[model samples]
Target: MSTVAANAPGAAGGGLEDVAASEASLRRFLHGLPGVDAVGLEARAATLGTRSIKTTAKAYAIDLAISMIDLTTLEGADTHGKVRALCTKGRNPDPTDPSAPRVAAICVYPDMVATAKAALAGTDIQVASVATAFPAGRVALPVKLADTADAVAAGADEIDMVIDRGAFLSGRYLDVFNEIVAVKQACRRADGTAAHLKVIFETGELQTYDNVRRASWLGMLAGADFIKTSTGKVAVNATPPVTLLMLEAVRDFRQQTGVQIGVKPAGGIKTTKDAMKYLVMVNETLGDDWLSPHWFRFGASSLLNDLLMQRQKLTTGRYSGPDYVTVD
Candidate 1:
């Protein structure tokens, strides 16, 4: 499958007509979706109450995707180091204590992917890059595909691409779907170790729960390995309610397709408590199968400090200084 042909506008084999039909089904499904009423809130609360403190914490360690706008900034360096340190195995400076959970990957821009990859070399941590004009995702198809290819060639283990939400919202659902399928196809490596594709829906821009659900299903059907929430570029990013909607979409998709796709709620996740809430949602909505790093991920830069603080409190029964535990 040549990248050019895969993304060509209205290329033969399957054209916009198929996408229009899929969109019609999606719209019908969305219109038929039940409203967010009191019953739904109660059920969600009940599910949250069942999660254990330990399981929630374990989920936190799975993956932390950090986005750095400027690699030269001190804040960016600090965030990167913290992620690298968390992914380290075995004992830290505190020999008596066991190492913390490994972070699945460190996310950054294309130029910085190599730096993160080098820092995380010889470890289980992966290097991920946001390609195809992230956040807005308004660029041309060929440009986006080439950007993805360049990032992967530079050692990015995972490629996070934003869907053309404008097209989907404007009723051009198939265009967005085909773009993702083509981008995923372009991620192949020389040795056949292709980079994983995470399709960002930017849920904040999607407006309604119905739209979110439809976009989730469309992305999965179009071959997205993971469906992520926001680009963190907007004021409102990942929220509990929106995440709840997306979780239901992935769960329902799994039932129908028998393929388990990953879910990442990125942007604006700040504290350990916030991360824990997401973990609770995943546990309740998706169950134990999607509990590991392979199935779930959190994308944030400030979240690591809070998680570490909470872990220290759990271990020593006292609050400790930032220096006591080294950040990556």
Candidate 2:
């Protein structure tokens, strides 16, 4: 089977419709993917999670992990003040120590993009917004497009949109594919640049490893810059086995298509230990090419605080008290 790929950076998405010209063809391609080996996958993920690093390398991994975080706040009560504070923290993760790295982006609702952008003006930190009726993704295509356009207009460097899992689970693969293509279109800016697109699969709801693998391909073919694991609101999000499966998908997709996409495992990744395991999985599965913040991220809020605490432990040779880091 011929593989489909998105265009280069600054290009939103194109030339993928023919690959899924019909529901049958799309279904054929998705279902044709190699089935996942559940037991082997889980065991490997467990083994990778047990990897250890020396004290010096552990500091590097902790810093790298800190830099790859998508500092996020997606609550209904989010305000401009909260968003600004989040941006400040993202720009300077550790206030007392200047060595802490800045997070990749400040993730918030569409309305908070400008505030975040303004707060992080001098920094390279991207402002990412969740659109297309995030977490549920139950809106119509037009509404979803408008939602995406609003974020792009609001100065979001990245748009994290959710796939309509209902359509995907119903075998309406073409509908989901078309929606992603359309959302990619909506991510374009007037200056000919584009906000990077990240497609969220909310894996816990998919019910099987096979579905996760299928969704990963569908999103990439539709031109996602990143294939994300969850909305972080689910009962389960960003587990090691599921993340390993996604890492494998991107690895295979790139080998065939020659275009690299990113992966983000969001939610429930609070501890530095959990973050390190995911980092090890990325390194071992996809290698160092995907190790940077450009390709991998932890969709976390509290995880940064933990990384800060661990960082302090490494530098001071003693654990910081719970009150050491600000509770965001």
Give the candidate number with the greatest TM-score: 2
Tens-place lDDT digits, model 1, residues 162-266? 998889889777678778878988888888667888889999998877688778877877777778897888888987877877888778776755667778888
Cα lDDT of candidate 2 equals 0.88
Query: Pairs clashing in candidate 2?
Result: none
Question: Judged by lDDT against the true structure, how good is candidate 1?
Answer: 0.67
lDDT of every model, 2 decimals: 0.67, 0.88
Model 2 C-alpha lDDT per residue in residues 1-328, reported as the tens digit of each score: 0011334432322333456768888898889899999999999999998998769999999999988999999999999999998988888888899988989889999988989889989888988999999989887889999999999999998999999989999999988988888888898899887888999999999999999999998888888889999999999998999999999999988787677889999989999999999999999999999889989999999999988988998999998877787778
RMSD of 2: 3.7
Q: Name the weakest run of 10 consecutive residues (lDDT summed) in model 2.
A: 1-10
Clashes of each: 1, 0
Top of the candidates by lDDT: 2
Superposed model 1: Cα runs more than 4 Å off: 1-98, 325-328
Alpha-carbon error at 106 in model 1, in Å? 0.7
